[model samples]
Every structure is written in C-alpha cells, then in structure tokens.
Target: MNSVYVDLAIGLVIAFLLFSLLVSGINEGLVRILSIRSKFLWAYLRDMLDGAEGKRSWIPGTIREVFARLPFGNKDARPKFDPLPPPVRSTATTWSGRLYERLREIDHNTSGRTSIAFVPPGRFAVAMMEMTATEGGVPAMLEQLRQDGSPLYGPLKGIWDSAKDDAEAFRKGVEAWFEGEMQRLTVLYRKYVRWVIAALGLVLTLFFSMDSLEYGKAILTDNAVRAQVAATADGGAAALERRLRDKCPEHPSDPYACVTEILASPAFVQIVGNAPVSVRIPDTGDPQWLWNGGDWLNRLVSPAHWPGFLVTFFALMFGAPFWWDILRRLTGIKLRQPDPTP
Candidate 1:
C-alpha cells in the first residue's frame, strides 16, 4: 500500500471529521437559540386560539363552546333549561383560558404565561378529547362541533367535508395543520441556520488561526505530521464508530447522538496531537495586493483562508452524517488504489 498517500487521505479525513463535529455543535446551539421546540408549540396553539397575532382570519375558526354542560347545543334545547328567574344572562368564556390551562397541565412552563407559543399541542388535543367526550366520543363531539359552526369547523371542515367524515382523514388533517405550519418555519430556520454556521465558522477560524490551504499543503508535504495524523485517523474513526454504534443505530438524521462527547474523545486528542501551523496569507500573485483594502475581501473569497472556512461551514450545514459518508467514500478510495511502492 502507498502509505504516504493513504496517510494523507487519513489526515484529510480526520480534519473533515473535526470540522464536522465543530459544525454539529454549532448547529445544535443555533437550534436551541431558534427555539425549535417552542415554534412547533406556537403552531399548535395558533390553530386553536383566536386573536393570535399573525393569524389568518379568513381561515375558518377552530373554536368550540368549550364550557358547554352537555354535548348537545343551546341550553334552551334541554327540557328543564334555565329554571332560574327570567333575565339571568351571562357571557361565555373563550377557549384561550381553558386551552392555556390544558397546556399548563402538560408543560408546566406554560403556567401563568400568556404566550400561545408555550402551549404543547398534542397534550392540549388529548385534554380537549377528554373534556368534550360523549357517548360517541371525541369524533362524535367533533362532528357536532362541526355542524354547530365551532372554531374547529374552519380548519378541519374541509377534511371531513372531502373525506366523507372519515375519522382517519380528520385526524390526519388536524395533525397536518400543525405539521404544515412547522414545515414553513423549518424552511426559514434552515436559512438562519446557514447564517449561524457561517458566523460560527468565522469565529472558529479566527480563534484557532486555522488556514485550510496551509493545513492541506502541510498534510500533503509534512510526511511526519501526515503519518501521525493518518494513524490517528484510522484509530480515532474506528473508536468513534464503536461509540456511535448505539447512539446512531439505523438512523442518520437523529441529531447524531453525543457529538460533543465524541469530539472530546482521546482519539481526537491524538489526531490533533501536533502543534498547529501558523495561519498565513496564501500568495495572491497580484502585484498590488499590498496596496488595496479589497485584498482583505479578496482573501475571504479566495479558496484558501476565509473561503475555506465558508466551505467548511457549507459542508457542516448537512450535519455530521453527511461528512461521515464522505469520509467513508474517501476511505474506500484509499483502499482501492494500488500501492505505488517498487
């Protein structure tokens, strides 16, 4: 085997994996800042609450008389309706209060909070089923609510209207409402996530004085460093795989379990065991490079320093699994190539 080329390949793999780990950590941090979980909660409550900001009023309302004493409509419909003296009128409570209460029961953080975004939707839905249940159960009550022009009639009516009142279809439609909202937010989040990656990558490069062009050249030319990095890569990757076997079983998209811990492992310590080379500007060949302020900007877009940082950020936007796949491909190439030794 051509140990030198294989070693250089390993060095590159380790470098990529190192960046992948850093990117994963940054991505997770960005997601936390973006309140990914809370956004879904907001989407859930938006469908249920009235007067929620940014709501589409034209959409049919999903409200129901949540406080009704019986599954049947108007109290006057009962034979013994309102035995009290005449002129005893009262106002009904809005679902917002009860909905908040429902959410607080599951996510205690929702207590005393006015924001609809804090409400946990799945729990609220279950609570509604329990509270509004009848002999025919939640579906039957929903059917009644639909006909009575309850708030739910707006968002869910189309499903029952089109699906011939299929319970599965109604459930799917209700679930889809929240999922669709979340999907839109996801698209926006992805854009912000990329921006966050770029910002974080910039800080990382500056902090470590990392120059990808220099590192690539060093790995190719410094035989001792390349050999050491290759050895580290082979062992470190194997160790990381063993550790990840349980955390990432059968799924590549499950947030790549324990990324921070894996990155801190002894294997990583060994991989970067050598002192880092100093970051330096790559030769531009432009004679006026020293005279121009634009040279700074030029270096950023150059495929060496800041641009390299951007490349790292862009790759990391795909998450750890993606780079791991690339590592595997690189490893495969290393295995297949014939040794160049005499």
Candidate 2:
C-alpha cells in the first residue's frame, strides 16, 4: 500500500478510538454532576436559553405549592399559571444545554486535573431523565400527604386548601408553584441542550461536505487546466491574408477552399473581422488554428455567460472543510468544540 494511504488508515483508526472513549467518559460524567434534588440549575438555564417564557403559568403554580409547605410560609398566597406563546415556548428549548453537558464531560477527561470530569455529565443525564419521569410526581406526593396528614401536607393543603383565605393562599401557592416549576425547567433545559448539540453537529457535517467538493475541484484543476495560449508566430498573421483572397477569388462557397484562402492572406487579420485569435500550437512553424473557432469560446460569448463572478466565487469557496480536516489530522492538531455553556 502507498505510505500516505497507510498513514491515513492508522490516523483514522486512532481518531475513532479516541472519540469513542471520549463519548463514553462524557456519558458517565453527566450522571455524576447533575443532582436530582438540585436540578433547578438545568431548569433555570433552559428557561433562560430556550424560548419558554410567559406571563403566568405552571412555573409559579409549582412554586406556590412549595412555599405553602414552608414552616413560616403564609397559608393564603395562591399561584396562577399563564401559558407562554408558541414561538417563545419553542425558543426556550435549548440544544446548548446538551452541548454543555457533552463538553463538560470532554473537558473533565482532557483537563487532566483530578480526572473527576467523568462524574458531571453522567449525573446530568440521570438528572435530566429523572426530571422528565417525575414532572407529575409532585401530585402523587401530595396525594400521599392527603392520606397521611403529614407535616408535608401543610404547604400543599394550604396552597390549594378550600379552608384557607383566598388571596393569601393564592399568593403563597404561586410562590410554591414557581419553585417547583424551577425544577421541571431544569429538565427542559437539559433536553434543549442535547437538541442544540445535535443541530450544530448537522451544520458542521454539511459544511464539511461542501468543503470536500471544493477541495476535490481544486485537485482536478491542477491536472486538467488547459493553457489557452496562441499558437501562431506574430508575422504569420500577414501571410494568411494572401491565401484567403487567392483561394476565394469569387468567394467560393466551398468551406475548405475559403479556409485555405483565409490562411494565405496577408491581411488575414482584417478579413477575420478583427476578433482576437489565439494560436493553436506552440513551437510549430508551419500550422496554426484560431482558438476562437472552438465551441468552448462560442459558449463563453453566449448570453448565458452572465454570472461570471458568482459562479467562480462559489466554486472557490466550496469544499474547504475536507482540506481543513485533513490538515488538522496530519498535523495532530485537535478540533475545538464550541462554547461549553449555553
């Protein structure tokens, strides 16, 4: 096998192995870093990044429930829910959170510090999964509170209790509802983060694909580009005029004879209508053909040749990633991930 091919195979194998191990480490870290109880970090992050904002909604509702249970908390504050519009709600879904989680895992391994980097991402995934699974778990917990009449029931009962003062309970309920919502928000944030990461990966893949094509085009040009230099000597122009007039004495309709006469004319240049003619062959003294006679030049002069710069510029810019990736691998330079935080 060629040496370059051998090197490429070896390099690819190594990169694959490294990436695999790296991803595995990240998975483990996510489970370690994010906690089930304190997962509000993820929720808050998601709410901030994703377009899930609204006036009043389940967020405050959940918060109110939580506060109503507090020992010193007011029994009367009730929470209200206001749903956000579709666009803002959709925007709140962040792929950046997932990206951050993945990057955190990678950094933990690569940073070479305590090597505890594997812990965070592993925990994050677990926390995210739990959040989704438990969005309505609070209601179950409240049901349990109703049956047992436990201290935990105070806040839950107070926020929604028929006996509590309407205004005070509503206010407290809203506070507790918001607090609980903050938890669910973390889950949403994690999911959004993953989404963002997937999106970025797709975009990068597309750019690389285009880059590969352009790089290939450049390589083709290197071997196949034909120089369009003129073939005839400077003085040969005069001789051709003499030939044209003689052969076409009565302007023969025969194409071959007309061509022969044109070749012999001294003022051949003038008879050809002053269009620029390129010489056909280099270093040959006896024969030369006009470059303008070919179909290629005819096409160039056509009306369709309008978008010169746009076509040329696009071709030049395309296929850059293939070259870039090749260069980075050959030089042992690492590709940098985008920002770690959303």
Task: Please report the TM-score between candidate 2 and the true structure.
Answer: 0.19
Task: Give the candidate number with the greatest lDDT.
Answer: 1
Residue-wise lDDT of candidate 2 within 245-317, one digit each (tens)?
Answer: 4445655344344444444442222222222354433334755756444544453454453253233223332
Stretches of candidate 1 off by over 4 Å are: 30-36, 51-100, 108-153, 163-169, 176-185, 224-307, 332-342
lDDT of 1: 0.47
Stretches off by above 4 angstroms in model 2 are 2-6, 13-190, 210-342
Q: Write the per-residue lDDT of candidate 1 for residues 139-200, one digit (tens) a residue.
A: 56556556544565566556556657565555555556656655665664455445556666
Alpha-carbon error at 147 in model 2, in Å?
Answer: 15
Error of 1 at 222 (Å): 2.7
